[model samples]
Target: MSDFTQQPQNQHGSHQPYPGPYGGAPAPQPQPVRNGLGTAALVLGVIGALAGVIPLLFWVAGVLGVLALILGLSGRGRAKRGEAANKGVATAGAVLGLVAMILSVVGAVIVFKAASDVVEEVDKALDSASTAPKDPSTAESGAPAAEETPDGKPLAAGDASVYDDDLQVSVSAPKPVEAGEYAIGHTEGNKVYEVSIVVENGGKKAFASDSLAVSARAGAEGATAEEIFDGDTYGKGFTGTVLPGKKATVKYAFDAPADAKTLTVEVTPGFDYNPTQWELTL
Candidate 1:
């Protein structure tokens, strides 16, 4: 018998030694797969949706929602193909993204509407004040003035006047006050004139304070006058909300040339095109 004897070879009775079954090297392990896009989409969608309620953040919310939608769809596709996890979360994210986008659009529309309303109010105020003669010179330009109506009679100091829907107005005569202890002096070669006015709102709506304006013209038979105060500034003119069926008294100070003779004071109630003028002899 040889030192290395063959194992039992029964069937073929071959003289070759029987070799054990050959085995190859162990196979490489697969890398652990990870997909986080689904979670990312879900988080962004939720945050964007919440932010949509804020007026200032609505625009940002819209952008984030769109991004979430894209990512969520991609994540959902991956989940369906078994390439990623969190399929339910991805679906929820997509839905939330759509809702956030819609809400954002609605919010933007509301903001624009509010802004439009404000602009309209401003327009109305401006229209109310448009009755003033643009070129104070028009009254003295050698052109014939409009025939003054009873309600539109020119006012002077201390005249009881009524105009535009029964609004009662009165102004004290313009008195010259030299800059002294009780008064501030007018600019060089100018005279300070003070007028006290009482306005009664007979209309149904509350008076818009912004609609009040005062303009002065040269009192001379042919001289022109320009606006000295528009009631735009506080303290110097009338300002504040006047409720319906209310009355307010305001004092006005005007500076004019010392020689301005015939002074006309025009009072305008807010939002009405027609204005009432009072003629006063200095």
Candidate 2:
């Protein structure tokens, strides 16, 4: 009788160790919950919040705020789901993102309102320009209309040149005179003439006669005639002021070439009045 104590033998079976407590491959370490989304959300939220205060950057702030809000919410959800470990950080990021969004909305409103006001002002200015009356003296070419005068001819002696609808200036016909032997501005071969300038003031304001000016040209060559100052016979320009409704007159002498056929005299009432001309046959 063979000993029947035969060890349990299996067909090509290898001996396996008995499982022990805490032996299974040391439960795979859960990868550290990546907090990348939460960190990114925090950073973006901070930037967006800072940009939200500037009016010109309102649009940029709005775009960044939207992105931050979406990212923050996503990160918060990830944290809540236990996919990320930074739950507090994610919540803070979401709060900041919400604040940034609110500020961006306010900034956008301010920017839009300012732009609207500027546009309205521009429109009003354009309307005013369009409705304003055109100046009657301005021609279609934007130049002042030509003034009608005595056919571009100088006024005759004794004819008044009206100014400001109140003042009248007239020049008398030239009277030939013999120059004194030692007269100041007379050439030996030239002739001298005396003329009178009369100014009638019809307006309420006194005319400043001290600023009056007189000049003369001789012959067809338009040579400047020399003024002759001979004792008290000829005075220098005008003096003082002409009272309203009064008349002022001054006599002047001019020396011209011996054979000059004509004399042209110009009278300026004052610095304010345009100079008027008178033509005289010599």
Candidate 3:
């Protein structure tokens, strides 16, 4: 009978028979596999997200993170191919990438808001300082030159003497007054009025005791009053001295009438300042 179990032998004088069901030769072995792409995507995504290096490029990193996450969710099917990477890393990358994208948008908004505030503040300062004598020539000659805007336009009521960048005072008008509007800088409705001034020490350094005093006049003839540096003025009034970086918010109101046509506000916002003082008119 034909020998079913006995297969042909090797020709090189070997004892092993040809590979077959009965030949006893080693069975064919599958090739080793790897999941290198998934691991790499996860790592790149995580690094991008944490570093915030390319916030504007979130789409790229986020996409990578998602792709890695998908592969990881597959139960590490390719790990059997020999790429001994972890599945958790892919998920973390996805989470971080998404977070980075959201934070980037928030950060952008904050930056824009800060920039706009600074610009508005500077404009107000320039406008208020408009009346300031610019031509050392004319000012020395005692001729009242026309006020100019930052870019040299006719000064507007929005003019302010204090710039937020140079100084930031959280002023409280004791009585409700427009903080930064046309009606600001005056107590009277028509612009003529007495305005009590108060500057709050809202920074991180010692400011001079006189830094909080402010004065206002109606058409150069309005009544003016200072927050008395009395015992009652501490902490919340002009009376107390500001400590290094401590707060000294002053509160006081002035007589603002509805019939006046013009008013001017003045103050010195710093410790070393006894600056000719700043003025804003409305």
Candidate 4:
């Protein structure tokens, strides 16, 4: 038999096995070094594109992209002289970061414009309904308005005043809503909670003026309530506008921390006013 196929005896003892496939050592891998500025550019770029994210991140991304591009171009020359570096990664980081930066600026401008439009719409509504009567604040007599429902409150009988009642806001689902389809949505890693509406007026004069002030229930109160936006309600394209004699539709879509089966929308008149709540499906 030829020696190539035969097992050989080791020095002074047992048989030795032949080496398997290409000698046994693992193949070498490309080492990954930290691409400093490149990494920063990439991170900033990702953050900048996020809607509802802090606007400053976009600026940071643009700045970092510039830095990465400069360093990468210069470093490419150094690498040929024996410096270990990642030219491709740095280039990509710079490009993506710039894109994020540009988009963020555009997004901000759009938001500003939308806000202006909202103000105008409110003014128009108020002017058109200027003849409608205004109601007293909840502080005036601690009473519910005629448009309000008990929802579960005891009312003292006397002269019936609609201003003494709590408003009825119900949130019903057309079925279960999947996430991300609504404005007030429920998704992981999102920043808002419990979107709702407030009817400044009801009946034909409920929206006494088109100049309405509508804002989300933000910060502390919302946090303490742990209320979240309903996927179903959000999907319906819920939006609120003060239309005298017409129903005011307030819509909210945001991301929340967990899954919920019940969500509520609270309506409050502008300024220090007693608010009302309407429930929605989670």
Top candidate on lDDT is 2
Write candidate 3's Cα lDDT for 60-178 as tens digits.
54455455455554425445444445545545545554555565565556667778999999986675564232321222122222234453332233222323222333222223233
Higher-scoring candidate on lDDT, 2 or 3: 2
Clashing pairs in 2: none
- The whole-model lDDT of each prediction reads 0.66, 0.77, 0.44, 0.43
- Give per-residue CA lDDT, model 2, range 17-37, as digits (tens): 445777567677775687887
TM-score of each: 0.45, 0.47, 0.32, 0.29
Model 2 compared with the native: what TM-score?
0.47
Hey, what RMSD does candidate 4 come out at?
27.0
Candidate 1 per-residue lDDT over residues 1-282, each given as its tens digit: 689755776678865666668966799885543467778788989998998988667897899799889888988998888777788888888888887898789889988888999999999777555534222222322222333344334645555444434445667777654444334423566666766777665556666666677776654653444323433321366677667568788866666667877677777665464566777677
How many clashes (backbone atoms < 3 Å, residues ≥3 apart in a chain or on different chains) does model 4 have? 30
Candidate 4 per-residue lDDT, tens place, 182-242, comes to 3433445444443433343333434332333322332323532223345454434333454
As a whole number from 0 to 100, the lDDT of residue 88 in candidate 4 is 61
Overall local distance difference test of candidate 4: 0.43
Instruction: Count clashes in each candidate, considering only residues at least 3 apart in sequence or on different chains.
Output: 14, 0, 16, 30
Sort the candidates on TM-score, descending order: 2, 1, 3, 4
Model 2: residues with Cα > 4 Å off, grouped in runs: 1-151
